[model samples]
Target: MFAASIKSKTQSLRLQSSRLMPLSQQYRAQSNLSNNKSYWSHIPSWKGVSNDEFVSYRWQLRNTVSDKLKLYKFLDEVLPERLGSTENEQLKRIRTRTNFIEDAIAAIKLAPMAIRLTPHVLSLIDWNNPLDDPIRRQFLPLRSSIIPDHKYLELDSLHEEQDSPVPGLVHRYPGRALFLATSICPVYCRFCTRSYAVGGNTDTVSKKPQKPSRKRWEVVFEHIANDKSLQDIVVSGGDSYFLQPDHVREIGERLLDIPHIKRVRFASKGLAVAPGRILDDSDPWTDNLIAVSNKGREMGKQVCLHTHINHANEITWITRLAANKLFKHGVIVRNQSVLLKGVNNTFTALSDLIKSLSDINIQPYYVYQCDMVQGIEDLRTPLHEIIDLDKQIRGTLSGFMMPSFVIDLPGGGGKRLVSTYEKYEHGIATYKAPGLPGAKGEMTYTYHDPKPVKTAVLEEFQQRQLEALERGETLEQFFAQSAAHLPRSPLPNPSSNQNPLRPQTTSTDIVPEFWAPTPKPAYAYSQGM
Candidate 1:
């Protein structure tokens, strides 16, 4: 009887120990969806709104903060401090019709890509401190972006245009083909690799048409269908989620019809920028997504949704809800993030982001080094920093949660593992891309330091130009004379409105619209009213 009592005590002790352990280690870990968190509870605008209304994707889209005035009004209400003394001065300048700051802001808007912010994304911002807000940094415009620095960077950083056998499809890899379905995004990221193509940039060097027509799509489909070697197809654009539900469904159906096509993945930022596009039960797009996913499942093919989420802060409760809904519908979700300086560059930031994604059942895929895209020199971090950060975070997280640090080699050379750096020197690192053409030699890349640009340096440069002009030299003559000695690309002519980089084209055929069925009024979809 004493032995029996001891055995009972031992069992009780074991049970207690098990209970003391963290819930994650206690059993097979499930998704963090079981934990309830209300991300939108703090929003004043959402107050007194029904859950149905709040969750409605259409409501989110319809109420998107598109205009500068709307954005200013929202920020004023929430965080009056954002438009502090400096912004107030700028506003005063605008009210007085002064052209200083007003012209600067106007130039930024007119330069290629325009500003676009969804209400759902805006709600994620900490209005009190927007400048430091990761979400705002990714979407909001800056005057520095208009400045012509980082002349070394190419307009087509990845050389995507060269790799494209067709206008809309990019076949960079052997078996995979990327289909540019639409050239529109819910929110335009400031550091977009394809900024030249998307957002209606008429000033791009590559004169390739923005969106594909019905005939162009047919040709693309034929190319994929004919190539049996191609098994995986990535449907992306400004964002594939921007496409209508029927269009997405049709694309999937067409891909499935190709017997060799084993996987169809949709690359979109909507899951992060605009989750309502997928989560709203009332929206027919969600139903169409489910139907396409189900069809892929029945055919024994992989249908996945790959999202671009850079920062940990981007993963909100609403994002999780949208992901969870997709999960329930048997769609596999994954995340790919760009490793931008001051963004997700730190070990702590990346760790939190990867952990957050894993918790939501979305696998962290790739942490790509910021591409050598023009106008994004401020965002790019050095290769050494990225490598060190990757090492620091690798062992701390699960294998699936850890992302591969990769760099897409310039001139269509393709993505290379950043770990295999052939050489490192003074601000220059050489990497040997896997399947690049010609000699298998390491390619040298230069990355600038993260220090802020000195105002004096810019002033000095401008002062020299003014001095030359005062000496009776024409601005064009001055620039032309400077170009002979300088190792930089020639600056665009200020006298001509036409972009010198843009190829002259005479084609006048109307391309088929990919967003909505019927043509809507310009005000309905204009970036900033």
Candidate 2:
């Protein structure tokens, strides 16, 4: 009887694989477009560029877009006269080249993050349908889709500034610390949680940029050495990728030398956005990283690279080769992805991304809820969406491959599982961080979903706001005249430490129901949950 049962199950497994084999092959083929194609040549300026030139890390840096004029020129060259239409009602107004450019420039003026894009990332955007493309949505701000910030959205949402013991070192958790080594990235994300300090100053924000300097770093290093309880250190900045090869080695070695430090993670999104650097033999960035990993292993401490790659589309042949190089070299690499509204918020997108990552041997570490930061209300999904998506994706992957879906609680309460909420109702979800030290452990933190606006009303509001922006009205002036009648949002928990960072509302409808019904399970290959 046992043999018969086993035989039947084995036959069933064969049947399932046979059916999925073709689709899986198709998926791999579509994903490896860079296998033969020079993907960046699609852009006008790089039409005649060779693969060697394109793969040079220096070439990517020299061609990176930083200022408004370069960005505008790129947009003019890439966006078609008439863009492909979209299912997104909020982004419908951005169909024409003129509509898209004007709306984007205006959005840039209001954004907290400045524009910065590498040629590799630029090449990945589907210009034919820029507005709805996930890569474009993550890096570029669109005024048409911009909405009023939830009353709780803040510039420094996690209260990093409050917990920062040293100027750039954030000591929040008992044994862990975030060493912000710089304030620049190869590409500035529109939804950056560290907008308070990263990137150049935008029109709406004056930044406290943390430039790389050994003088400044010594204080941070000394503090870490003295703190006997510290065991983990996350060295992040504009990005460790922006650091010189020497900086990477120095920082990694310095931290590893500390007696209490058991782990050192150098965080950067370079492997995803500018992957060629890992393959550039002339560059020593990858060499330094590998050296540190080997040294840490010999010392019985762990040193690894924590990269951010949110979408599977961000992974190319270069990304795969880069990941493989690290894996073969004994460099441990892990990924942390953000759950953006139009990006990887669905179970299918999220699960596919996880599978794609694990296939390259990069552990899918954490799927973070979007932070409560300024200028990115458009990218945030309601809290329940993350909770539901987590349920749908958990059992689909191997136990070790599954990621922790969490929200880094809005004050300094730290990361907790999405389902660990103390109370969730009326578009508001509250949690307590008992893991945090002091009274903060007993205090409650809160997260409010972006307020709703009916589609027609929101589209109208965008049109009016865009008109005001063109006529020289600042983002502040436009909101000042329109907020009086909108509904009030829930205040933060009194015991929590977040100060409300609400912008005056242009308009909003209440999100009355916070609890959603348990969703039906998704098919393995479905496009959405």
Candidate 3:
């Protein structure tokens, strides 16, 4: 019976592949286009172009010519100037791969693939053109934060088991534990903070750690049961939803048995990276989500599916259908996005993304600044750009749709809010600022005013605020600090024991509080002060 089912699924997948453009054919099309020299004159210079400007240019030109043809022309114009002197053949290879993907996407028939192609289009962007500077292009944070990857299990480090659970099971938080379940993903992101574990193609994980055997799942449960302080288990892997339905149901049952484990959350990118996995009702993973939700409810635990979607364009019909199914099964839905340099870095892009997510009943969660994995240096956007983009997004978006922008400190300290730094310039740090762009610059708003201006006071004040944040201040503390609201001078430096950028336990984790559901608002709450 099992063999029959497996064979049935394989056949179904093969059928689906037939309707799709074969990756090989797509590659050949792009290669043929690139070899044609006729389109070279239309190619534009890569110089003096900001990522946003480049995107605008692509959209403006998209109708005039095919994306593949445009890319062929683009490469022709820039290759001579950029690749002529560089020995890093890797960059050239990536460009070629990108060209193929772009051409394929331009002709894709599936709605989900169309949405998926949007990020690929954005990825080809160049945000660091020196000529683009001073133009102040918006960007997502793709750098290492206070929380570092070193704190977690490195990819190549494990061998005894297929998967293993870390001892610090319950991180700094009382009710949350990070569950490393799988080491697989359909697409490898360049700026993944957990790059050491995800995207096996990169050599970064070649010498890291491996997961222990399934027996280790019990070890994870034992840790959760022993730690009365913890009540929720965040089931994460390269992507938790990647697990089979039976595995998910079994994990759910185990968590449900633990009276203390009140929630089971699946952190999965499958909904975004490989929505097809979830689109087919016959897919076991799709069944797993329903089964897990049922088990959680039966055990009285809140079951939620947290999806990672970085752009508005990623909301495809397949993902939308999958999200709806999860919700119908009594599973709450939420989304987390990582801010990256060339992808969804602008206010317009973020605003569009949030609106789309909200429309599908997925509450916007954290918009994490990118982590500090090696090779992701290309994805880091300036901190100031994130702040500026947040400012633009705050008013237009509903409060629920606005995610807390954060930087996960390196060395496993945990996530620290990045958007709170806006308070440094004003004389005082307050939750609601007085000088937002449209609110008459006097009315109160969610953001705070920077420390008051004083040539003498400015630098010192910024230093203090920066120091405090590095110390792992919560979103509330970072923005709420004022001369009157703070403790005595020489205020406790949260990061005093280590570099602020590296991870340290933040105030939120130490408190003996259970993970509580955010209270639903009575009405459409505006970001009114």
Candidate 4:
């Protein structure tokens, strides 16, 4: 009887870790969807899947919408016949499901990062409003929306390859090295800065991947062991989440064993894109992560997870539970978001994301300016967007809750403050990173805004993208050929639009028509909206 009481107490404690007593219940009652709703059921094919099967990591992997064939099949089933439109002129014309599928297919052919989507991310997309859905914009690109690449963009925008002394290891900073553990991710995003190496080869970019293998990692591990100046290591690549549970344990334990290593961060988007994996009792990934964090604490060192979460919609009740479970077991998690043009560039969108993450105990770490990477010009906002957003978001939250608005500089210059530019004229801004050592610190890195487009020629460029695909031309060749034809009227200067003394007009402020979509009156059918 005494043993039974102990077991009962333990179960209650577990519930406290895995469930938000008041908030979860309230959310469930409102959505009738978050806690017990098999939201995945909305997908025609997954209609019969139960909550248990949907939560399993194995099941998620087996059902991942990978490659062109699987994606086309899934989109056909999930997307409504009539799609909603967005104010973004580039995508406003895609009003039907068939049009969207065609654009997606063409975009996949030219995109640098390959198309890969998890069930969770797929489920989050408002398929009814497929064109403007922020989640769709991130993972699946639309060829019709493609714009000419920024002149400064490169396939390997960060110069990770040049910075590597050994394969799969980037030693850009003096005291730290980024260990490329695996060139694989649960889901691939359109704006990945590591476009040259992160995903399976797309037509536009052939990946030189760092496959996840113990033998492959031995060289990276050895280099860290030998380097006395290295105090920090970030295990990232496609993502650390792709690393096996045993692999996570071994890598974390090994890094902790390094004599001079003071901090270790495993970078993964798993928490955002595949939160169910963390909550799955049958899976050991989170268990291994917790073990690593605990071991690091025992050794008087720090081990934490650095996740990428761009928008608030990405955070569901499942994500909250997963994050809570990690926190309950003492895992330190932080989020870094890219300030995309339409996604979280607005004050309301960005603020909502920050608060949602903080509520789940994930510290909002860095809000990055979208990197000037190849083939996703539509996503990259001008440098002023971040500068403006950084100004608007300050003091709205506690100092700790606020994130640093930063730009990871183009061509190997590391992350720097967005507002710290040496010069700003037209669309180009220049910055110097003196904190970096040697010649790097002395260099002035320049960042360019996405090329401003004339409304008259938007359709012309769209035609060029599809024509280039038909001719079997690479995206690089297409951009090079199309650059001179693109309109280049100067965008308004950032200073002219703002007054620090009063309330300001930020880019994110939208009219009723452009504001986020509301649920349909009768839920729009299909087990309903």
Best by TM-score: 4
Single out the weakest 10-residue window by summed lDDT for candidate 1: 508-517
Put down candidate 1 lDDT per residue, 165-192, tens digits, no spaces: 8768888777998999888888878788
Worst 10 residues of 4 by lDDT: 520-529
Q: Quick one: best lDDT, which candidate?
A: 2
For residues 30-74, write the lDDT of model 2, one tens digit per residue.
343345578887899999987767878899999998888888898
Which residue runs of candidate 2 sit more than 4 Å off their true CA positions? 1-35, 455-529
Candidate numbers sorted by TM-score from highest down:
4, 2, 1, 3
Per-model TM-score versus the true fold: 0.74, 0.84, 0.52, 0.85
List candidate 1 segments past 4 Å from native: 1-50, 67-107, 144-148, 202-209, 436-452, 459-529
What does candidate 3's lDDT look like per residue over 152-180, in tens digits? 21222111121223431425433576776
Candidate 4 or 1, higher TM-score: 4
Report every candidate's CA lDDT. 0.64, 0.81, 0.47, 0.79
- Between prediction 1 and prediction 2, the one with superior lDDT is 2
2 against 4, candidate with superior lDDT: 2
Report residue 1 deviation for candidate 2 (angstroms).
Answer: 61
* Colliding pairs, model 2: 182-238, 184-238
